[model samples]
Target: MYGLMINELKNVLVAFICTWGLQLLTGITVRNPLTLLYFALFWILGRCKKNEKYDDKKGKMADILWGAASIILSGSVTFFIGRKAVLGFDSGLFRLVGILIIFAGMFLVFVRLKDLPSLIKNIFSKDYSFLAVKGMMQEEKSRKELPFSDLKVLGISAVICFLCYLPYFLYEYPGIMTADSLVQYEQIIGVTPWSNHHPVAHTLVISFFYKLGLAVTGDINKAISFYTVAQMIFMSLCCGAVVLRVKRIVGGIVAPVLSLIFFALVPFNAVFAVTLWKDVPFAGIVMLTGCLLVDMAQKDRGVWSDLIMLFVLLVLLSLFRSNGWYAFLLCIPFMLYFYRDNLIKIAVMVAASVLAVIIIKGPVMTSAGVIQPDFTESLSLPLQQVARVLVNDRALSDEDMELITDVIDTTYIHELYAPDFADNIKELVRAGHPEVIENNKGTYLGLWLTLFAKYPADYIKAWFDLVGGYVYTDFPYDVGNVDGIMANDHGLVPTPLIGGKAVIKGKEILIKLGSFVPIYGMLWCAGAYTWLVIFALIAVLKNGRNKKLAVIMILQAAMIATLLVAAPVIDFRYEYAVVMLMPLTVSICVIIKSEKTAKEY
Candidate 1:
């Protein structure tokens, strides 16, 4: 009894320490006390339920109610707090308090109302039918004969991935034409070797190649070429890794071949792979992380090693883009569903990840002074001036206009200064213009609203428009247009026979068609319309099944749905990273089904 108490205390201490350490490093305050309080309450409730005099069936009912309530309440609180924060309300403190109160009230109600568990059990008893289904699945797997030729499938996948990216080494593909790419290149080649706007991973990769190229050819262009080729090779290897993992799961050679074929044939994949953009790499890391997670779920041995790999992959993924932070959210469903039995371990892992991000982005860079911004005031002055103009119905003087432009240009340079608030403000002013400020404000608000509303269809349409606008105009041939052709306003170029139309029209048609067809397009969309049905069936049929797989599917669905709404006009380039996830998921699902079928036979 004493040992158990000590262990529980130790676990709680570890979670608290890790969370606080990360908060300190990141300089973010958890203003909501209720958040912590709720967690405490939940912990206590769980402990009490475990120690109750009730039988296993009764206690299980209590656990289920607790879980269901937690999910609903957490979602509600997150939604409200997120909205309040976005709208400029300082609700963090209140949110914390409210969560605590809610949790406390719920805990008291559960304690006082002993019949609550029975009520919940009556309401949710049907849900347990899924467990029986899952038991059958396990039995099926046990009865199946293990296949012998799986290794050959993995080998073939490797060969296919290698061949797909070979052209990138032999020929130059004009990289992703984004403002961000230019900034990344500058950071890599510049003497300072850092950019506040860009993440560290891609720049680091580029710098390594630059140095290597200088050693060999002594030409800057050659070095960039080498870097680009290397990035392509690495991306190709990621594709190969996904294919191999898929083969392992599916128990057939076809899965690997299909994954390779789908990946290679994707127009955006081909374009992004040949470029110096980080999207492909980011996608690779995410896929790799997913593969590792699946492995950890299946095999209980060496879990620590698998977890370490996940941590490293997450760090790398985070460094790929500012939005890369969202990738961490993937773990949420996994914890809530699959890792429920290991709550303490999950909490520790989350805390560790938060700390890693803070250390990488904060103190490490702070010591180097690479994040300071000057001209921040100048940047803000224009926004104020622009607001005055708009509100007062006055035109800006030519001098004011010029100052605003100068401020916008210089803001980027000023952001290089780290940790110094004054310098940071100055740089912000220099890099900002009235129009830029307005656009940013609008973009953020739009994104926030879209996510809160969760309108998946509207989100998908907007994303398509954004992609069409960016890629077709920037890189014509990737969408099946001829090279050297200039795309017009709608990302279409005039052709001798076709006159002028969007370059992506053809690609878009195929994407739409493939999305409906089985084993093609992105599996998420292919399965989107039927998602609720599929999920319902899985929940009922697969008991104690690999819960991680189901959680991943849920996360992916949520991510894609969020992307559909919140993503500022999408470019095919941005979509490139997420596209890899779909094929890999499909491969896993197929593998699971095949294994089940074999077992039944």
Candidate 2:
């Protein structure tokens, strides 16, 4: 009895520490009342029936991994966030204490998990294809017939998305043209040099519409507005297609209705739909590609057109952004594995896509003289790490100083060393003898590796400062407020068509509410979406036989992985693809897994 009481007390204390750590790690106010709720929840979980009789060594690995992830992740965020703090305790020491508490919290979580993993074994083990994705290939009849036809499903969903997006379009007329959009516009007008830095394919797409709009309207702003409206329609159709795909897979009006609500009402979708970013179209194709993968995997053989569509989309996917190509490449193995039943056709399509991408990106771009992005673009992590070492006055060998100064002027570093952003330092490299490191690849690699070994703690903090937002839920990214075009030198700016006090304030209220609203804002949260995807994947792994549903998720996961390694900015738009497909991901995982699947797994 005494032991149990002591254990409970320890659990409560651990819960408080982790709860506070999480609030701080996520940039939440330390004084929020929500900590008490989390503390109570953890205590209740700890007090639940505790037994480990059923779990095996294999399941223990899962617990350990989760615990280790919690410790490391929390520790990382804690260290990075506190780096600039003036607190008396050393930032490193504070991080160590935070990690210790987070570890204890993970212990409580393991206690809550109990022996469920071992119980998962019979726990209803069966043909997983039947159990996991039973709803995928066929449609179950509704208790009452759904009135909507297939075309109606597509049209209805599309119209709803467009209409929902209309307000954003009207609010920020001519579209939200930021720095990248302005650059694209300059390239379109022949004022700036052509470059694949902003994908030629995407630039061409914009060029087509803007030129057409000019011919029709003879007004640059109108042309831009025309492009925005057209983009909204195109993206709406894409989202509608996503909704239709999800509805068919889940079967019924309820799923479609809910999906419509998510696609239409979510501010991220609306804002992104009208935004003049290449990623908007890229995300659309990504979602469609995911849907197609789902369709092909759910059947023995897909329609004949699936191959052609796959080829075309893959080419465009590879062309839309550099990262898109890499992400697709990363998923090829997984795609082959999950959709192996249709191996020959899938392989042919993928090979063709790869060839097409190579041809376009290589000979085609070279012939067109589109300048590729500087090589320094790929060295975001290493650049930030080196800069951190310089900024913090860490001891460095003369050779290290020479190597860094060869690429970056240390004098400018004080002004350039932003903890989270790498662009300034990257520019510094470009400003210096940029090709020095590029030409000496082996030398640079050795320098990066050696520096990492020397400044392991600084390296970790530098990386976490940039990437922790994606892993920490409620990381305070403002998606809804990025409504209007930024000030641009090009003849591009916001020409808002709708603005009375009510309309403007209503939009303000929406954006402001998202900042403080608890669950609602998660629609725009990278970490929330990431965690949700992970949970769905776990569901698939524990219960599902074939991995089609899980395979489709690789689309988002691959893109996100690319971002983690090389993301320049922790912008909401970068992670929007995950948010776009999350509803479908959750729906499929939920439908496939049974009541017993949850109980056992």
Candidate 3:
């Protein structure tokens, strides 16, 4: 009893000190709410291993690894917040000591994670009692399950989604178009040469609707409005599909109702639905593709119709964004691994999709005089790494200097250096001397490798800065605040149907809420969604009942990995597919399957 009491006292000290330490690491404040959260986590973790014992050698190694991981995550979040907040972090001994204490506390929490898989498996057991609701739902399929019919429920959800987005569309009327949108519009209207930098397929999608509206309405603004309305309808239907699918899988109204709220009422979703970005449609299609994959996987066999649909979707997915194609190709291996029987059909669809992309990108684009994105677009990481070495004044050999000079004028390096974005450096290359690097790839590649070998630390810092926002959970993003299209000469402008301070404040509050609110704010965070995907994958693996869902999870993860490696900005729209996949990922936990299906994995 005395020993237990002493142990309990020691744990209390650990938890308190850790909580205090985390507060110091982030920011020392009297009433920082995160302090309470940290303490509770530490205390609970301590309780988890109250009497646990392990081999001294293995236990020491495990503790070291987990401790290192915890510190990295915590340190990344701390450093990112510091840089973004622009408050110079105190490099004091107290903060250093605080980090040490934090590591110890966070180690306690992570060490307890060893039991998480078993805990998840037990909680979401193979029996899947939650899914028994499906059988009851099947019995009542003919009968009106709720007061309203299922079709009516679906319509209600979609309409609500449309109606919620109506205000944003009207307020930022026609649609919200960033620089990329305006550039695409220029390509569409012949204001400039057509460039496939902003995926020509998506540009054509806008042009189709815009031109149709122009013919009917004879006003450019109204024509753009036409595309916005169509996009809203499509996105709403996607939300409706989510609602119906969630209802079917969970076999309950509660989960579906909540899912509807998430899809329809979230401010970011509404803003994105009306935003003229390729990512918007790409995200919408990713969800649909994921849903289709889930449906096909369950059948354990494929038909010709399924192959055709998958082929079309894969082609559309690829054409929507260049990265989307890479992600699709990445997913093919996982698909083949799990769904081996359907491998031949999957391969054929993928092959055909690749051929279509090639034809469109090569012959069709070339024939139409559409310019493709420059090779510099794919060199973001290497360029950034090289730029980092220059900006930091890292030691460079004469050969390294010559290689960089060949790519871009060395005099412009300081002026073009942007630690978090590669565009400026890329632009320098484009403006200075792209031809030299383009013509002498081998020399530059050697330079990049040599610099990497010498200044690996700088390369790591450059990567972290570029992608830190996507790695830190609470990183702030101002979504909906950037109202309206960029000032354009083509008569493209915001024609807000409503105007007032109240509307302005309402939008501001909604956008700011992401920073002020806790769980609700997490919805807008790409990093939070990234962790959600990781957690969902863990749950699926532990329960071992949703390998098909796991396939989709891996696909989402692959897409995120692509973003990490080559993404220019840590934009919410870029990671929006995983953000929108939240409800679907949750459904993976409760997907109904027979004993045979579960065992097949």
Candidate 4:
């Protein structure tokens, strides 16, 4: 027990040092560099002692003493550098006390090093192999010859999906209206000019349903009410599609039922459905594409229906989100590799998708009078760096400042630039200097590259602040607020179609509960994304029979890569597709094991 405690203590110290050391590198915080350096030395010496052939109590004691001395040295260095007493003690006296604490720590380690090697061996030994092997054996014994049909699961889940969604739809009767939805509705009703700033395809779809509602009932409110109900049904069908795919992978009813409960009761999915965002249907389509991809892989000869679904899904996915098209382009090579045997079909699909993009984005959009998205949206990171450098008053040569001025009004960037987000800076840049950007792409690119070379640290810090939410859990930016996007705004007057103040308050409570509840909160956090990546990697590596699931990872990775470059800010909605798809990815890895995997079990 004594040796085990020491080993655990060492592990904790290593983790602490690594965590803070990384923060220091990311510019999240500042730390005494010497402290990190000494901890690294301590870890090294401890590992060396562990590998020694014979007991060396004296050497272990000496090593602990060295670590203690290094800590005291670091404290003295901190005092000299800052010329401030640590915790009210003089620098000299602080080092003296710190040295004493280190010595006490050393003595504890000296006492425990006798059995340290054996304790560590016991901790990391291969004894757990039997557990894995035994579990596999039991699974093999219990394995069914044929899996149950997924039809019942799908039917039950769809009913649950609708029933679970009813309360939210009722509470926010017409809809959980958002600013984006309002803008889209206004465009449809001729209150504002139609533009393709949001996807033209989604807007056209909304216009069709909304107009149908208006024609049938003659009341715009009733139209909205009908539209909301229609959205709920569409989203419920999406939930059913996901359940069907999951059922196939897991080969059981329990997992699908649990998934149904997760979707049925989880406030986020309900809120997502009720709130109309381009990302909502985009997420649905992405999942459908994944299901089709899996289905194609399961077949020896690819089905024509499956090929048609992929082609249509790729087109819809591209139109819904601007980056969707790019993500599809990135995934194509992998898709072809996965379907190497069906090259002709895959080739035709790609050629057709390319042609569709040209026609839809060019002539079709031109006829519809939808303006193309601004080019600056694709340049979020560079703009962030420029604004941050201007804010920090970082060293910029006179010529460099001139080049930047040609691209943006540098004077107002300091006032408008948000330190941890890129949206405000983006607006400032695009609005302030439209003419220069419209004409001078090469010059701006050159200036950006030169400034990056000059203030590399500021550049890195700026980017980390923007996109660090994906990798760092404690990233200070709050990008997951669905309230603004889902606020119950239904014109100036209150009506039955409008969600009243009480319903809005209830929605707020649900959001908080979804964020703080034990398992539920995981769905809302950036930390969950880190685990999703880890699990996806495990699935890709472990499930040899179904390596096609790695396509999901490929698509997810493409999205993340796009986020690094194009995300206006680290908003959770931007990565929602990845988060919502995790269950299926993990199920494919763990439950859909190959016959060889079953033998090992």
Candidate achieving the largest lDDT: 3
Can you write out model 3's per-residue Cα lDDT over 324-426, one digit (the tens) per residue? Answer: 8898889877777777787787778777888997898899899999898888888887889889999889887786787777667778688778887888888
Ranked by lDDT, top first = 3, 2, 4, 1
For model 4 the local lDDT of residue 245 reads 83
True-structure lDDT of candidate 3? 0.75
Better of 1 and 2 by lDDT: 2
* Model 4 ranges off by over 4 Å: 1-121, 129-133, 136-149, 476-507, 541-543, 592-597
| Structural RMSD, model 1 | 20.2
Model 1 weakest lDDT span, ten residues long: 473-482
The positional error of residue 331 in candidate 4, measured at the CA in angstroms, is 0.8
- lDDT per residue (tens digit) for residues 1-601 in model 2: 1344456567666566546545434445332336546665555444332433327988778767876765565456545554333243345755565455444444444444443343344236742231232232223332233478878888988998999999889888988888888898999898988899888898998898999999999989889887888889888888888887877776666677788898898777787888899889988888787777677667767576987887888888889988889988998998788778778878998999999888888898899888889898988878888888888899999998898888777997887788878898888888898799989999988998998999999998988787767776635456756768777766566788889999987776666545533345556568777777778888776776656778767777888888888987677778777778777788778566544344454
Q: How many residue pairs clash per model? A: 32, 1, 0, 2
**Candidate 1 structure lDDT:** 0.49
lDDT against the true structure, per candidate, is 0.49, 0.74, 0.75, 0.67
Which regions of candidate 3 are displaced past 4 Å? 1-150, 590-601
TM-score of 2: 0.78
Residue-level lDDT for 82 in candidate 4: 25
Model 4 score (lDDT): 0.67
